[model samples]
Target: MDAFNLAKQRYADLGVDVEKSLQTLAATPVSLQCWQGDDVGGFENAGGALTGGIAATGNYPGKARGPAELRADLDLALSLIPGSHRVNVHASYAELGGQKVDRDAYTIEHFAGWVDWAKQRGLGLDFNPTCFSHPLSADGFTLSHHDEAVRKFWIRHGIACRKIAGEMGRRLGKTVITNFWMPDGFKDTPVNRRAYRERMEQSLDEIFAVAIDQQCNRDALESKLFGVGFESCTIGSHEFYMGYTMKNKKVLCLDAGHFHPTETLADKISSVLQFLPEILLHVSRGVRWDSDHVVALDDQTRALMEEIVRGDYLSRVHIGMDFFDASINRIMAWVIGARNTQKALLLALIEPRDRLRKLEAEGDYSTRLALLEEAKSLPFGAIWDEFCRRNNTPVGVAWIPTVKDYEKKVLSARK
Candidate 1:
């Protein structure tokens, strides 16, 4: 309490309203991707290779065995993280009760239990079509496959996913963001990459021909620069999606780790928003390439959130997280990444923007730089602690013991 008092006064001196920052930060919902809990291994089948150039290294024990365990793990992770949030679910995680149903045939019945679970917890849900890690994607292509039959199969899967997402939104009274990402690229330089892009454009057109309830769901297509086997080319490149999204007026999904490590999503957010009404933002960290490491409170995340808040684009930017780290405790990874994301947003919301902007507009770069650096050294930890208390979440390391206790009681027995 004393620390918070001091921090509040310190920020108030800079014309920063700490209370409004806390409120804005609290209202921001970061969707926790389901893949993190299961290491990109959904509940569709017992075991299969990660075929989409997706890799989750490390063999940490106590991985979720099924939906029940995954849900329990998510429940525990949410309790530790402050703020209301949403869950991002992939098509592969459908609960079909041991019945074999192809991806093209999935229905809302398979995910009805998830909706019920989310309703009970007051959590919103997001959807994604798993266009990788299946036999159809074994050739490193799905929607962009050369074979007509293969393209149709994946196209059907996309259509089904959109409908299911719409139902989830209607039932939950929240708009579900159904994002599409595929591993459609070549390991080696191909004779013709344009042919595949043409095929993919046709396939996407067919899949999106039938519209779902717009009020219930929003469609987003993601792009990738390159992957392990896809070193030379990626069909759904940023340029491709940008053209398609701009033409169709659909939400473009931008994954932080999906681009060249040099390119940052922070730069693309404002530019894309000028043409599109909104965007679906996926948060992740890449060590060198698109490694999908756990997200940290680094400059990338801080700058991305800062851009959104600075532009007043929070309502237009839908934020979600993507990364799977099997190395550490799965629950701990989620807690760390989610909490860091929220903390970054808090930093952004509490920024002394009015003063900084005034200085920038007047070309007072010297004072602007000084204030920016000084803002960093402010008592942010105290403000974060106070925000955690306001949300009734455990403040600081107090939640660490709870994770340890859960690991011992629940995770240790999973083996």
Candidate 2:
């Protein structure tokens, strides 16, 4: 028998259907972040270094300088990755045609090109408000600024982005999830913490009050424990967004790298779903800090996927990539991160959870533990290769040559 056939029988013995797992993985969509191609440096003329307590290291060659090149890179990356997916965009990445437009003034016209592109590919679109890397946000505040005018400016931007997202969804025939993640916090200890949070609360309310149809656009708030400069305190802490999401009945985004090193975001999935209707997950690799690194098929990623599948919360959870690594080939980084994410999900889908649950019910902890370890040794690689073959994507290291060739032909032309 072929390797995949043998592995299929092995999984069948454990009461897991291999074909059903593949079908599930094929249907689930992972929203690919647009910033990865340009290292969070959007094509906006509002030029400045990366701010809002974030940085993408390394000066890799062939970085996408404009919308056309970014789209081209994405086309290649998407071709290599298996399964259909969505593309996530930040407001700063709008195609303005050299026209000067500030954040608050942004409209769907700026992103009509993106909507057109997604429509052609039958892909869904997601959006963010781009609350960092601007003169107004240089003081480390956007939505929660001490200045009421500054807060109002950001609030308008948020409302405008939501309208654009609605249009994107309506045009594409898929719901576009708009995630609001602002880098508003203090570098030092603040004498008044509640005041800033209160301001943030009011700002969020004003932004969300201008609601469009949920089918066209849904809202989500992402929280961060701390960033590089804002180490002392983050106004949008986990507890803050938790309360806000629960009360407002909005989707909550749980970034894997946004919490402390000891806190696994996988643990928060089941807990948050109790109150909120759904969740938006930011799948990123944080090395010590929120140092957005390329994702690999590691234990953390596996555990995260396992939790979603085991709890039967796949439909309720929206998965999206949130890492950027300029240290490597930008295209390669995108492929590696995205492919690993899907691979981890495939592993999670193929897991014999029913047997494990039954073993747990019977208090066969020792057998359950032994079987879990043994299951990991199965020929999962064969199944994964077969999946790639079925999807017409390159198997194993076969895709690497395509990236290198693209780098030589397309990337090398960029200077």
Candidate 3:
């Protein structure tokens, strides 16, 4: 069957009303990180500091665009995909010399402006504060004890940004989701690294406390009925603060690709869901060595993964694509990545829980594998076609020409 029919049949079998399903689907917050081009040559060229080789090769088609152009490109690309409403802007101001410099003011203004622009388009913003700009963070944010100053600096920065973010949310009626990805762990002295982690949690407690106070104030305003709520979703390489905070204020954002190779993704999802049922997700794919490959979702794996994600806690789920591509046309990469990830999520949502449960109860690896194989067999193109048919909406498609194609086109035009 086509995707729309499949979705309908699955929903019927699962006893989910189609109208309610569509409403839930429509309400789902889909976002993408704006810093993908930070390390690559792009519109916001920081004197080539963030450009990793694409610009050097002279193949950077998007290097000349500014922040306005980048935002426009994102707007156009997102309009092509279905169910994409949120865009995460990476507001790492450490490039401006931390809190001690005047650059922090400029960075905050830049982000506030972007947040306002996105609000006009009815999109939400997810903020990742400055964490990856210095060698002091080579160990990780919230995980480095040796650099007490760096930790303290981040705490201050977090508090300041929380205020700015809270103000922006109040003005725009959107929640500012702050994501914390601490690169705090040890490669050699794993035992000694425990102290570093402890300090990290302490720092996080302070940050989370501040975020809660700011959000409570924002959530209390009656005249400003924007329905926005602030959340500090912590993404870590390890479960350092699994059950540390109360519900709704601080939550864990599981990065599906961040787990070790030995740990099953399904098991990891189940463990986190069991402890904290309502959580956010930073979705991506990787192989043995690479952690973020930006590859197409593996059908069988994603089906089972989605089953876990759609349990009692699906409403609390916020989706964002975390991938790094050094290509020049970062906009096109973001567009394709977002579209593919959304398709994967839709399929997972439509799959029946009982069917999956039966396969799991069989206790045979092949039986579970077969179920996933069936889930993966659902053709994405067919599904897209069906979605358009059922919704009576024309598909918005973009033709992002590759580097070679662009080169040939540009040269031919010059002649």
Model 1 RMSD, rounded to 1 decimal: 0.9
Deviation of model 3 at 339, angstroms: 1.5
lDDT of 3 at 178: 65
Q: lDDT scores for all predictions?
A: 0.92, 0.91, 0.52
Q: How would the candidate models be sorted by lDDT, starting from the highest?
A: 1, 2, 3
Query: What is candidate 3's TM-score against the reference?
Result: 0.73
With a 3 Å backbone cut-off (N, CA, C), the pairs that clash in candidate 3 are 139-183, 140-183, 140-184, 142-200
Stretches > 4 Å off in candidate 2 = none
RMSD of each: 0.9, 1.0, 8.1
> What lDDT is obtained when candidate 1 is compared to the true structure?
0.92
**For model 1, what is the error of residue 75's alpha carbon versus the real structure, in angstroms, after optimal superposition?**
0.2
Ten residues in sequence with the least summed lDDT for candidate 2: 39-48
Model 1: residues with Cα > 4 Å off, grouped in runs: none
Candidate 1, residues 1-415, lDDT tens digits: the string is 9999899999999999999888888888999998898898898876667878888899999999899999999999999899989999999999999899999999999999899999999999999999988888888989888898999999999999999999999999999999998889888898898899999999999988988989999899999889889999999999999999999989999999988778878999999999999999889999988888888999999999999999999999999999999999999999999999999999998899999999999999999999999999999999999989988899999999999999999999997
lDDT (Cα, tens digit) per residue for candidate 3, span 1-415: 4556665665575454455545555567667766554433332224434310111222444432346545655665565556647776555422332234421243455565576677788777766654443444534343345677777767766566666567656666776666655444433334454566567667766766664344422211000001011011222334454544323335566565555555555555556666554455666664663235464757534643475545645665567776666454555666667666766666666555566676677777687677666655544455555554454433545244442354355322421
lDDT of 2: 0.91
